[model samples]
Target: MKNILITGASRGIGRATALLAADRGWSVAINYASDAAAARSAAREVEARGSRALTVQGDVTDEAAVAAMFDTALDGLGGLDGVVVNAGVVAPSLPLAEMSLERLQRVFDINVLGSYLTAREAARRMSTDRGGRGGAMVVVSSAAARLGSPNEYVDYAGAKAALDAMTIGLSKELGPRGIRVNAVRPGLIETDIHASGGQPDRAARLGAATPLGRAGSADEVAESIVWLLSDAAAYANGAILDITGGR
Candidate 1:
């Protein structure tokens, strides 16, 4: 069976992806930052789907914590076949000039640096020459990278843009070594992330702008992420698959 490690699996898109992947028969490693209760509940659901699930606790921003999370997953499942680098952070909406350096750094520390650290470790353990099945990685980016989310949180967008670039480069760098890296740029989704950003109305505003006249669901984005890790996307390396409904 395939083993997939998903950061931020306690809620939102990460949780949704874990559910879907488990249903599809993939062993799931559910990583949560602080909500162990939620993580355990999600783990139970994943187990209900007839696939093994392991719950790991660690802050994504810490390299040691990230390494330990993976180590626990590897110990429990023996190996990892794919990973979803989905943990992220957002500060309150503020103009670029008004945003504090500390806030910006907080977002980047978890979103950009954390993603890099996770993918870096995965690459080391998943190298084709190491004698295991090739691995896949899917980063959850945001449409704000292109929309520019002016006056809201451009810094967050910028961080995601960096993630997008990393996904492309990593995909190319690891393709020859039998690894694939890709990203899913999602539009507004009904998740606690907006509330965490101190903008509970974000979904409404984004829905008005979306051509679909509605915000996407966490499940919708998660579906795309799961597909990107599937064998059907073997030829689709270094691609940023947009889940936004036409802008």
Candidate 2:
């Protein structure tokens, strides 16, 4: 079975991807920042799906921790074929003038910088030069990147927008070496991320704005992620898949 590492697998879309990938027979390393219990529980679901599962703990923003997490995960799985950089945080909803530098940095640190750090390490380890299979890296971005969420959390949108730019560059840099890099921009997904931004009703409101007139489930986003890593997407590289229900 192919081995994949999914960051922030303790809850929300990351957890959903772990379950889906495992159910489809992919060995999963569920990385959690602080929720060991949740990670273990998710691991059980993976194991139940007849796939190997390992629970790892680390902060994606910390280079040393990220490095160790990937090392431990690869060691447990014997190899890695893919990585999903799904862990992120939303800055509190506020006007740009009211947003503190600390808040902006924190959001960028975890959402943009964290993905960069983790993806860099995953690329190094999973590169063919390391006697491993060339792997795919999927970043979970947000539609807010394009929507700009100016009235609420522009910082959050900017962070995701930066991620899109990173994926574009990384894809080109690594594509020649057989590594694929891509991103998923999900819109109005029913996830706890909104709650973290101090607006638990944001998703619902945004959903109503969508052409589909409903919020998407975490599993819906996970399905897109699973496909991007599958052989079915062999020709897909550096693709920015928008999962919005027709914005």
lDDT of each: 0.90, 0.91
Model 1 compared with the native: what TM-score? 0.97
Model 2 — which ten-residue stretch has the worst lDDT? 123-132
Report how far off residue 217 is in candidate 2 (Å).
0.7
Best by lDDT: 2
Model 1 clashes, total count: 0
| Model 1 stretches with alpha carbons more than 4 Å out | none
Error of 2 at 222 (Å): 0.4
Per-residue alpha-carbon lDDT of candidate 2 for residues 1-247, written as tens digits (9 for 90 to 100): 6899999999999999999998889999999999899999999999999999999999998999999999999899998999999999886789899988899889989998899999899878877776668978899999989989986889989999999999999999888777899999999889998898888998898799788998999999999999999888988899999999998
Per TM-score, the best of the predicted structures is 2
lDDT of 2 at 107: 90
Look at candidate 1 and give me any clashing residue pairs: none
Name model 2 segments beyond 4 Å from true. none
